[model samples]
Target chain A: MKFKTDRDAKLGYWLILPTVVAISTLIFYPVFYNLWLSMQEVNMNPIQPNTFVGLAHFIDILTDLDFWISFRTSLIFTITTVIGTTVLGLAVALLLNRDFPGRSVIRGVILLPYVTPVISAVFGWKYLFNPVFGQANYFLVDILHLFPQHINWIESPAFAIYAVIIFNIWRNFPFAFLMILAELQSISASLYEAAEVDGASAWQKFKHITLPELKFVLGALVILRTIWNFYKFSEVYLLSASVNVLPVYIYEKAFASYDFGQAAAISAILFIFVLGFIMFYVKKVLEW
Target chain B: MVGKNTILKNIIFVVLLIILLTFVLLPFVTMLSSSFKPDNEQNTFPPQIMPENPTMEHYKGVLNPDIFPFLIYFKNSLLVAFLSAGIGIVISIFGSYSFARLEYTGRAAIQRGVLLVYMFGGVLLVIPLFQLITKLGLFDTRTSLIVTYVVQTLPVSLYMLGNYFRTVPESIEEAAIIDGCSRLEVIYRIVIPLSAPAIVSVFIYAFMIAWNEYLFASVFINSSQLRTLPLGLNQLFYTQHYVWGRMMAASILTAIPVIILFLSIERFITGGLTFGGVKE
Candidate 1:
C-alpha cells in the first residue's frame, strides 16, 4: 500500500510539471522580463543591445502629466464600472432566481453580451451611438426630444467614459449574475421559510437574510471586476480613442510613439500597483 | 381585493421581464437589422430600425475573396483557436486531476501560486512577449499567438476543471489501479469519460478566448494574410471608404457561432464559472 502511494505521488509530479513550466515561463517570466526592460532604453535595431538607464523611465513616468491623467481616468473607470456591474447583477440575480417558465432559456440569453466577442459588442455600441446616424441620438433627440440635437456620446471625451461604463456594465453583469445566482441557490430554503414564518416581508427578508448571505460573493465579484476593469483593453480601446485609459496609454507609448522602454515601465508600475491592491484586498476584505 | 392585488403583481412581473429582455437584446437586434440593410440605407439619418429594403449585398461582399479576405481570417482564427484550446485542455486535464485527486509534496504551495497567477494581466505581458516573439523569429506567425494563448487560460482551466474532476468518485480510479491499470490509463479510460461535458465546456471557453483575442493578434500578426478575425475586422473598420453595412455583417457572422456554442454548454459553464475568476 505504501509503495503504491509513493508511485502515485511520483505520477502526480509528472502530470503537473507541464503547467508549472508553462505558467512560470509564459506568465511570470514575462512579468519579470517586463520589469527588467522597464529600467533600460529598449533598442529596436538588431545590432545594438538595450542600454541600462537606471530608473530614468520611472522618473519620466512620475513627472509626465498625461500619465497622471490616464491613471486618474483608469481609477474612476474601474470604480464606476465595478459598481455598475455589481448592482445590476445583484438586481437581476435576485429577480431571476425564482423559478419560471423558460427560465433556463432566459438565463442562457442573458450571457450573450458577455460571451460575445468584444469586437462584435463594441461594433454594436458604436453603431448605436454613431454621430451622423445612430439609434441613441435618434431616440434621445428625434423621438424623445430629451436633447436639442444629436450628440457624439461615445466619441466625445466628455461623455465617452459614461458610454464605456454603460457598455462595460452591460457585458460584465452576466458574470456577476451567474456567480451570485449560484450562491443564492445554495442558501438553504429553510432559512427563508423560517423568515417567512416570523412574518417577514420580501424587503425584510432581502435586507436581513439575503444581503448577508450574498456578502462574500459580492466582495469577490467586486475585487475581480476591479482587477479586470483596471487593465481592460480591447473594448475600451476599440470603442473610443478619446477615452484614454492606462492600457491605451501604454499601447500608444509602445507602438505609436515607438517608445518601448517607457511603455514597459508603465506596464510594470501598473502591475505592481494592482498586485499591491490585490494583496491588501485579499487580506483585509476577503479575510482568506 | 386579494385577486386584484395578485393580478397587479403579475402584470408588473411580466412588464419588467419584457423591459429586461429588450435591454439585454437590443444589441443583437441592431446587429441583425443593420447587416440586412443596403449600404445606402446603413447611414441614413434617423436610421431605420428595420431596413426598408433588406439585401444580401453586404453578406455577399463579406464572403467575396477579392474584397475582405474574411474567409482566410476566419480560417486562421479557427485553426488557432482549435490548436491552442486543444493543447491547453490536454495539459489542464492532467494538471487539474493531479491537483484535485493526488496528494503530493508542495501541492498547497503551487495551489496558492496559481491563485496569485490571476493577478497578472495582458497589458503587463504585451511588451515583453512581443520582444520574446520577435527574438524567436516567430513574428507574423500563428505560433506566437498559439504559445501565449495556451498558457493564458491555464489557471482558469485548472480551477474550473479541478473543481469538476473532484466530483468523480476516487474509488473507481483506485479499483482501476488495483487491476494493474496505470494512472495514465485510468485517467483516459475512466476519469475522462465521466468529465467529458465539463472538458468540452472549458475547451469552448478557451476557444472563445483565443478567437476573440485582439491585443497580441493586432501587434504580432502584421501580414494581412495571417490576420485573425478580431484584427481583420478591426482592419476592415479602419480601411478607407468603410461601409457600415458590411462591417455589421462581418460582426454578426463573427459573433453568432461562439454565442450558440456557449449556449449549448451553459449549464457546465455556469457551474465551473462560479469559482474561476473570469478571463475578461
Candidate 2:
C-alpha cells in the first residue's frame, strides 16, 4: 500500500481489466456454459435452439460401457505415469545433484523430451515402435533377446496403453526432474555434512535427510501430475487410436461422433472431479 | 577429492550418466537419423543409427504443396503463435505489474481465482468454446485460434511475469518515482528493460503453447487450408500409406525453432516455469 493514492487503485483495476474480461469470457463463461450444455440436447440447426434434457446425457454416459472404459483407462494412466515420472525424476535429480563436467549440458538435454512439441515426440516414438521398421523390437527381440517377438506396441489394443504410459513417462518425467532438481540443489549441504560427521551410511543419509526434504515437493508434484494426467489429451490421442483415455474419449464423443451434448457431459463429469481434487489438494498439500 | 578405487567409481559414474542420457537422447537420435534416412534405409529392419546415404527427399516430400502444403500450415502456425504470444504478453505485462507493484482490494482473491482457472483443463473449455465459435461464425478462422490461444496463455504469462516483477528492488522504483517518472513510463522504460530475460521466457512460453496446441485447433479449424502445424502433421500421419521419413522430417522442422528459442533462455525459464510448473 506504499502507493495508497486513489490513482494507484484506479491504475490497478484498469491494468487487470483486460485480463479479467478475457478470462471471464473465454474461460469462466465456457466452464459454466459447459455445464449448461451438458444438460441440453444441442440442436445442429442454426435457427433451432438447444433444448433442456435435465441429466439425461449424464445418465446415458454413466450407463455406457465406453465411458467406464475411459474412466478406468484414465485412472490407470494417471496413477502409473505419476509414480513413474516422480521416481525417474527423483533419480535423475539425485544423479545430477552431484557435480561433473558438462553437467549443465546434460541437464538441458534431459529437458528436451518434456519441452519439445508433443507431435514430434510422438512421431519419434511411433518410429521406435513401428512393427517392422522400429528399433525397439529389433533391439529387444533380435539384439538382446528380451522379447520373443516384435509386438504391435502402439497399434494393438492390448499393449497400446503401455506405449502411451511409456511415452507419457518419457515426455513428462523431465518436468518433474526440473522441479525436483531445483529443490535438490536448494537442500543445505551443511545438513548432509552433519549427517556424515556421525559416520552415516549413504542410505541412512538419504532416508533421513533427502526423502524428508523432498516430501512436500513430491506431494505437490504428484497432485499436479495427477490432475494433468487425468485430463491429458494430446499425448494419448496422438500416440494411438487404440488408447482412449478420458480426454480423448471426450474429443471423439464430441467431434468424431458429432454428439456435443454427450461430450459436454463427459467434460462436466471431469470438471467436477478435477474441482474436487483441486479443493482437497489446496487444503491439504498447498495448505491454502 | 580422488580417493582409492577412484577408477572403478568414476567408470561406474560415467556409465550411469551414459545410461541415463541414452534413455533421454535415443528418441531424438532416432528422429534425427530417420529424418535424414532415405526410404530404403528408413524402412530397413534394425533401424539405422546413422543413415549411410542421407537424402533431402523426405524433407522435400513434406514441403511439397500437394503432398503436405507445408507453407500454409507453417504460416498458420507462425501467425497464430506469434499473435498469441504478442497479445498475451501485452495484456499480462500490465496485469502482472499491478500484481507485483500495487496493492488493491480483492487482489489476492483475484490472483487465486486466476490460478484456479489455470487448473481447469482445456478439455473442459473446448466444447463450449467450439459452440461459441460456431455460433459467432468465427469458426475455421485463424482469428478464432488467435484469441483463444491468447486467453489460454494469460494465466501462465501473468504468473511468470508477476513473479519476475516482484523481484525488482523497490528502492530503484522509488527513486524513479521521486524523480517524477510516471508509473506507466517507469514500466515502459525501466521495468520492461530490466526484465528482458523474463519477458523472453514468458513470450516463448506463450508462443510454444500456441504452437503445440492440438485439441482446440483440431475442433475449431475445420478447413484443411486453415490448419495449424499440429493439425497438418496429424492429417499427414492419418492418411493412407503415410511415410515414416517425411513425418519425421516435418516433426524435426516443427520442433527445431521452439527448441532453439527455449535453449537460448534456459536459465530464465527454469525460474519461471518451474516455480510451480504449468504445462501446455
Candidate 3:
C-alpha cells in the first residue's frame, strides 16, 4: 500500500506534533535548563536572579564528605536491592515455573507486593517494624528471643538501610519474578529432556539449559533495575529519612536547605551516572 | 512406582512457596487487620495478627473532616489520574500512529530519542521542572501536576501504543485507503477499534503512573487543598500523633483502587510493564 509521499510526510508531522512539542518543552528543555542551572547560583527568592558561578557548586559537591557518604550509601542501596530483588525473584520464578496446582493464583498473589501503592507498602512496613509496637519486634524480641531489645529499624541509621533494602526487595522482586517467569515459560522443554536423557543431574540440566537462555533478560533487568534503584527516592524517603541515598540527599539540599544550585550540581552528576545506564539500556537492552 | 524423592521435592517446593508467600503478605495482612483493630488493641504487646473485636471507628475517623480530609485527597488523585490518562491517550494515539504507519523525516530518530529521554531519571529533572512550574505560575495547582504527568507518561505511552499499533495488520488500513478512505477516517473508523485493548492498557498504565507518583506531586503541590493521596498520607503520618489504625485505614484506602485495577488487568500488566519497565 502506498500513499502520496508529500501528503504522508505532512500528515506524519501533524500527527506527532503534540507529543514532540510536549517532550521538547517538558523533558528536553528542563534537562538543558537543569544543566545551565547547575552552573549558576540559584536562590529560590524571585528577587535574587541566578548568577552563573562556573562549576563552583560541582567542585563543592565533589569535595564534600557528605556527598561521598551519600554516594556510598546510594551504591550500597542500589547494588544490594538489585541483587536481592533479582535473586529472590529468580528463586520464586523457578519455583512457580514448575507444573503445580494453583500456580496462576499464587503468581497473582505474589505481584500484590509490587503493585501495591508505594506509600501504602512503606507505611505498612513502617508499622510492622515499629520499635515499640511493631510485629517484627514482637516476634524477634519477645517470641523468638533473637535480640534482647527492640531494634529501632526506621530511626537508627545503622539498621535503616537494611530496612529500606528489605522493603525494596519485597516490593520489587515481583517485577523480577514476572520478567524471569515470562522468559522461563518461553524456554524449550526439549533441551531439558535431552539433557536428562544424557544422564545429567537436575542441577546440570538447569545450569546448562536454563541459565544461558535467561542471560539476556537477566542482564536487561539488572541494568534497568540498577538505573532505577539509583534514583529511587519516594520508597526510601517514605520508609526512613535516616538512610540518605543520593536522591534523598539532593532533595534535602534543594528543598530543605534551599540550595538549588548545589542540588542541581549533584543532580547533574547523578544525571551522568544515569546516562551511562541509559546508553547501555538503549544500545544493549532495547537495541534501538 | 514413583519414589520418595518426588514427594520430598514436592514438600520442599511447598515449604519454600509458603515461606515466600508469608514474607510477601504478612505486612499487608498486618495492615488490614490493624486497620480494623481499636486503638488500644493496635499498640498491644504482641501485635495481634487479627483484631479480636473489629470496629469501623478508624474508618469513621478517616472520613471526619476535622481529623483529616481523606476524601479530598482521594478526589484529587482520581482527578489527576483520569485527566492525565485522558489527555495523554489522545496525544499518544496520534503520535503512535505516525510512528507506526507513516513515513516521515526524523520519525525513527524521534522515537528513539523519546525512549532515551524516557529513561532519564526523575530526580535529575526535579529542580528544573520545579523552577519551570513555578516560572509558569503553576505551583500548587493540579494543572501543574497534570502537565508534568503528561510529559512523564507520554514517552512510554507512545512506545506501548506504537508497539501495539505495529501489531495491527497494516493490510486493514491499506484496504481502507484503496477504498478511498482518508488517513484520518481510517484511524477513526478502523485503527481505533482494532487497538482498543492496547489503548485501555496504556490508559491504565498512565493512570497508574499518575496515581502512584509521589516526587512530582510532592514538589509541585504544597497546598493542603491540592495535596494528592501520597503526599497527604505522608503529611498525616508525620504531623499527627501516631494513630496506627487510622493510618492503616488510609493506606488501605489508597491501595484499593490500584489493587482493583491490577486484578482486572492482571494479564496485561507484565506485558505492558516489561514491554517497557514501568517508568519510575
Candidate 4:
C-alpha cells in the first residue's frame, strides 16, 4: 500500500510537470525579471549596457507630473466605470428577471456587447462619435441641442475619458447582468411570496429580499471590475491615446519612448496597488 | 381598475425594453449599415441610418489583397488562437487532474500561486515579456505570440478544469483502477469523455481570449505581414486616406466569429463566469 501510494504521488508530479514549467518560465520568471529591470537603466543602445540605477527610475516616476495626472485619470476612469457597469447591470437584471415575452432572446442579445471583440466595438463607437458625421453629435447637438456645437468626442482630452467610460460601461454591463441574473435565479421564489403576504410593496420586497440575496455577488463583481478597469488597455487605447490610463502610459513609455526601465518602475508601482486588491480578493472572495 | 394598472405596467416594461435594445444594438446597426454605404455617402453629416445606395465596394476593397491583405491577418489570428488554446487546454487537463485527484506535496500552495498569477494584470508583465521574447529571438514571430497567449490563458483554463475535474465522480475512476486500468488510461477513457461540456466551455473561453487579445499582439508583432486582425485594422486608420466604409466592413468581419462563438455557447458563459464566485 505504501509503495502504491508513493507511485501515485510520483505520477502526479510527472503529470503536472508541463504546467509547472510553463508557469515558472512565463509567469514567475517575468515577475522577478520585471522587478530586476525596474532597478536598472535599460538603454536600448547596445554599447551602453544596462547599469544598476537603484530607485532612480522610481524617483523619476514619482516626481513626474504626467504620471500623477494619469494616475488620477485611472482612478476616476476605474471608479466611474465600475459603478456604472454594476448599476446598469443590476437594473437590467432586475428587469429581465421577470417573465416577459422573449426574455431568453433578449438575454442573449444583451451579451453581444460584452462578447464582441474589443477592436470591433471600439471602432464602431469611434464611428458613432466621429466629429465630422457621427450620429452621437448629430443627436446631441443638432437634434436635441444639448450642446451648442458638435463635440470632438474622441479627440478632445476633456471628453475622451467620458467617451471611453461610456464605452466601458456599454461593453461591460452585460457581464454584470449575466452574473447577477444567475444569482437571482437561485433565490427561492418563496422569499418573494412571503414578502408579498406580509404586505411588502415591490420596492420593499426588493430591498428586503433581493438586495440581501445579491450582496455577495455584487461585492465580488465590483472588486473584479475595479481590478479589470484599473488595467484596462485595449478599449481605451483603441478609442483615444490621449486618455492616458496606466496601461496606455506604460505602453507609451516602453514602446514609444523606449524608456524600458521607467516603464518597468511604473509597472512595479501599479503591481503593488493591484497586489493589495488581489490579496483582498483571494482572502474574501476565493476564500483561500 | 386592476386591469388598467396592469396594462400601464406592461406599457412601461415594453418602453424600457425598447430603450435597452436600442442602446445595445444601435452601434452594431450603424456599423453594418455604414459598411454597405457607398464611400461618398459614408461621411454625410447627420449620418443616414439607412444607406441611400448600398454597395459591396468596401467588402471588395477589403478582399482585395493589394489594398489590405485582410485574409492573411484573418488566417494568422485563427492559427494563433487555435494553437494557443489547444496547447493550453492539453497541458491544463493533466495539471488540473493532478490538482483535482492526486494527493501531492505543495498542491494547495501551487493552486493559490496560480490564482495570484491569474489576477496579475498582463500590462505589468509586457516590458519584461518583451525583453524576454526579444532575447530569445522570438519577437515578431507567431511562436512568441502563441507562447505568451498560452501562458496568459493557462491559469483560468486550469482553474475551470480543476473545478470541473473535482466535480466528476471519483468512484468511476477508482473502479477502473481496480479493474487493472492505469491512471493514464482511466483519464483518457473516462475522465475526458465525462467532462466534455466543461472542456468545451474552457476551450471556447481560451480561444476567445486568444482571438480577441490585442495588447500583446500590438506590442510584440511589428511586421505588417505578421499582424493579427486587430493590429491590422488599427493600421487602417493611420493610412493616408481613411475609408469609413472599408473600416466598418473590416470591423464587422472581425466580430462575426466571436459573435457566432458566443451565441453557440450562450448557456455556458454565465455558468463559467460565476462558477468561481459562487463556488463557496
lDDT of 1 by residue, B43-131 (tens): 88867788999999989999998887889989999999999999999999999988988778899898898777778778888899888
TM per candidate comes to: 0.96, 0.96, 0.97, 0.96
The A-chain TM-scores of all the candidates are 0.94, 0.95, 0.94, 0.94
Mind giving the per-residue lDDT tens digits that candidate 3 earns over A67-173?
99999999999999999999998999998987788988899999999888998998899988999999888888899999889999999999999899999999999
Model 4 DockQ class = medium
Instruction: For candidate 1, write residues A231-254 as lDDT tens digits.
Output: 899878888878899999999899
Judging by TM-score, tell me the better candidate of 3 and 4.
3
lDDT of 2 by residue, B98-189 (tens): 88887789889889878877578888899999989888999899999999999988888898889889888878888898899988988998
Task: Assess the local accuracy of residue B160 in candidate 2 as a C-alpha lDDT between 0 and 100.
Answer: 84
Q: List the residue pairs that clash in candidate 1.
A: none
TM-score, chain B, model 4, is 0.94
What is the Å distance of residue A125 in model 3 from its true position? 0.3
**DockQ (Cα-based) for each candidate:** 0.70, 0.74, 0.76, 0.62
Q: Write the per-residue lDDT of candidate 3 for residues B133-189, one digit (tens) a residue.
A: 898889899999999888899988887888888988888888898899999999999
DockQ, candidate 3, comes to 0.76
Q: Which CAPRI level is candidate 3? A: medium
Report candidate 2's fraction of native contacts: 0.75
Worst 10 residues of 1 chain A by lDDT: A1-10
Model 1 chain B: which ten-residue window has the lowest total lDDT?
B271-280
